[model samples]
Target: MFARVVVTNMGNEMFNDGLFYTEQAELHKDQQFNKWRYCRSAIICFCVAAEAELAKLIAHSLRKQPHLSPEYTEILLFLTDPNSDKPIPKKLKNIRKKYNLLRRLNGLRPQKPDQRYMELTELRNKIIHYTFSSHEDVYAGTILDSTKIARDAVRDFIADLYSIVRETPPEWVNNNSSIDIQ
Candidate 1:
């Protein structure tokens, strides 16, 4: 009997969903209703996709370590082991924590995520916990820019992950196709 690894495909699915929403937004640009809805959905999907892909890369990096403490091994197994029964750490649920953890696991210095990642997260949070303030303006042009930023940021993260792991990215991961959003 051999150990089986389990990696979820949620990342790819979420990415595809984001692309779908982007396409829908472009297709329905002529409509008078729900012009921003698709853009909002796409931003959320892109953010989720980035988080899922980051977790996958971290798990992969952890598994490749030649000598890791039992604590880290436990985390790795929790992510990649099909039979793992270990409880995941609460902090690991946070995207920032996962990003730093990935860096540390790969023998890299942990630092704050870049501006693009920060922008994506901020946009995602604002949309997810929408609070309409009279002082804040939501312009169609700004929303379109945010949507583009979300897509580009996630694509950048995927490319960076592949570089960090020194692995060739899959076709889907490398396909940073631009959406023709107006």
Candidate 2:
């Protein structure tokens, strides 16, 4: 028998964080430095939240198969290990691979993230690594557009996951709940 993993309110938490950062960005729009920083932060936060939601869905699917419990545990451990030196991109790729495999097994078509999502990820990396020009060069409109892209990406991802989960039998879902994996 598989151990029941209770998914928590991580999805809600992620959404809330995204909302908070977006609001912060709006509040700081008058200041170039603050506006760019906050807007970039908001986009990155949304991406992070979207990735978390993906992980949750993958974990939930894995937990449905008793034989895959050990692998599922390993995935959880790897993801939560703050000391691990693996890059975020590599980790995300691994998770995506697993998610794709599970989707294939369930006869679901594979869905690649949109180009805007990739662009947002690249932008987030550039900002985090200080690869961009001075803050004064960062236009408010660009920041706003990036924020919208991130928000839309997260919304689409969540909708896809919900559709997949809905197709699964209730008993296969632990507690008939969404996985938190936070």
Candidate 3:
């Protein structure tokens, strides 16, 4: 009941009541199943929220100037602007549509994300879909697979964003790509 109240409050915040539902099969001897596992969301939300924030920062940095590599530019499109909830520059908007339409998004996105973005998307999907509860769960591909994908997605976005800021040397900016490993 304690967990239930918390989940209810969270649901109201996200405006997605379904987020609180936990299946009967998920219940254990003493613990009740919730539509969501607070621990999971608590942990995963930080990662997702971080990615969202980085996306915005990258977009804002890139938007100030123009003419970046096609691939880097693609990522900038999904990034948010600093001033508002507004999206990346109008020119960069195709990534979202392209990614959604494409069957396999490895190299780039129309307005969504690139291979790195898609990998992160898959990781987020798995976490959001409740496939992380046990070792025997069907997605048994490898926990490392999702973990590595998300880690690398963050790394790659940072690299590209860094490169744009460096290679072009945005006025008043002074920094190099902090990523050490490729």
Distance from true position, residue 45, model 2, in Å?
Answer: 1.2
**Top model number, lDDT:** 1
What is the Å distance of residue 102 in model 1 from its true position?
1.0
Cα lDDT for residue 77, model 1? 73
Better structure of 1 and 2 per TM-score: 1
In model 3, where do residues sit more than 4 Å from their true spots? 1-50, 62-113, 129-141, 167-182
Per-model lDDT: 0.73, 0.60, 0.37
For model 3, how does the per-residue alpha-carbon lDDT over 115-176 read when each residue is reduced to its tens digit? 66555555455566654463233233343334334334544543444443443322211221
Tell me the lDDT of model 2 at 49: 66
Work out the TM-score per prediction: 0.77, 0.66, 0.35
Give one digit per residue, the lDDT tens place, for model 2 in 22-97: 7777777777678777777676676676667667666566567656445455665565666866444333464356
Off by over 4 Å in 2: 1-8, 69-73, 76-99, 132-141, 167-182
For residue 93, what is the lDDT in candidate 2?
65
Q: Choose 2 or 3, whichever is better by lDDT.
A: 2
| Per-residue alpha-carbon lDDT of candidate 1 for residues 1-182, written as tens digits (9 for 90 to 100) | 89988765777778877877777777876662454888888888888888878878888887788887877777877777789777776548677788888888777887777679777787778777777751142435567667766777888877776676777765665445533332
